[model samples]
Target: MTIRIGKIGYLNVLPIYHPLETGEIANDFSIVSGPPSALNQLMDAGRLDVSAASSIEYARHPDKYLLLPDIAIGSRGPVQSVLLLSRGPVDSLHGETIVVSAQTHTSAALLRVLLAEWKIRTNFVTGDATAILSRGERPQAILCIGDEALNLRFHPDYPVRTDLGEAWRTLTGMPFIFGVWIARRDSLDRSGQAVRRACDTLIRAKVWGQTNIASMCALAAERSCLSREELRSYFDGLVYDLGEAEKQGMTRFYRHLAEHGIIEDVPSLNFLA
Candidate 1:
């Protein structure tokens, strides 16, 4: 039987699954890829057995899922893939519009927290970029994530960019976790060892990808239509594995979620062995 695994199809996560994509893992697993929010929706609806969901999703539904330790899509500094493109500076954001993409859950919340702390009040609009850009005036900043963020770099139409992950770190002095793998607790109990093996496979794949980044970048370039050098830069600048800093950031994020009543309680950072 093939184990169904839903993964985020973004470049930041490319390195983590490089080994699996290259057939280095012997396990019988089917990889389905999608955006973080979509994957979380699938996991919530039981359409997927396991998925790399946004950490906020896992925190929201802690009893239903188990976090896979030592593995995540994180960035200690500038995460090129998750960015907020602004037309003007932060100080000028007041009263100006900020368009938020529908593909995000954590970044939106994080932005709100930062804006509150920084005392930068602005009208937050949730809609499509095309619709927002169609107006006579565009938002002061447009929040973009996943492939859209990467694609924005090539367009040069958006002049200013702010890496949301980096911004959070600048404000809070902590790393940011955007995504994590979570197994259904019921299914995990039935096949605990298999779940652990899959998690191990992901960890090993990440290490191998980091060690052999050139080859990984080659594969990514072919897939993304980006040059090897450009692709390599994306891999080089990202932080793939979850460490202590990310754990602290995740805790803080969960606390914020709890404060907003998005979640009833803060989930312990529990991971399957």
Candidate 2:
């Protein structure tokens, strides 16, 4: 049986994808790639055996999916890649419309929590950079995540930029996790030995990538249009290990989600053995 795997196609996932892209991982499985939201949808549909998904997606249905251990996309603060841009005073964005990137769920949820905490009221719409940049009347703000957020300049851009990761840390004093690897609960039980292969492969990729970040940053720089130093700094701020502190962060995040009535309840974190 051919094991299926899904990965985020954004630059932020390079460390996870580096080994896979370089053929360091065994080539026995089929790999699917897309934005985090797409991967979440595909995994929910059981079209993917394993995939990276927004952390909130897992929280919403933890009973249906098992987290792949020890790997995640997280930041303690100032995750330069997850940003909210505003053209006016941040406190004054209450009644305005904000264009949110369609590629993420956790970041979008985080934004909602932030707004609610600030007692700010706003409307949201799904949009990409092109749509936001070309609209007749500019959006009061735009929430950009992943690779798209790395390029700070959007055509006809807004003036203010807030790093959502930093905001979360300052507000809650916890690291914010954006993405995690997961698989259908039943899929992990089927034991095509597929999940085993995927887990080993991803762990290997992460190890290799972290060990060679400097070189990886240079290569990513060529494609991302950011200087190698900038890419290095960005990568430096990201944490791949889903350790104790991250688990706490996840718990706190879910609790906040429940408090805000964003989700039905805070699901327990479950993992595949």
Q: Best-fitting candidate, measured by TM-score?
A: 2
Candidate 2's TM-score: 0.95
For model 1, the stretches where C-alpha displacement exceeds 4 angstroms are 130-137, 154-157, 260-262
Model 1's alpha-carbon lDDT is 0.78
TM-score of each: 0.90, 0.95
Question: What Cα-based lDDT does every candidate model obtain?
Answer: 0.78, 0.86
Pairs clashing within candidate 1: none
Mark the 10 consecutive residues where model 1 has the least summed lDDT.
130-139
Clashing pairs in 2: none
lDDT of 2 at 143: 90
Clashes of 2: 0
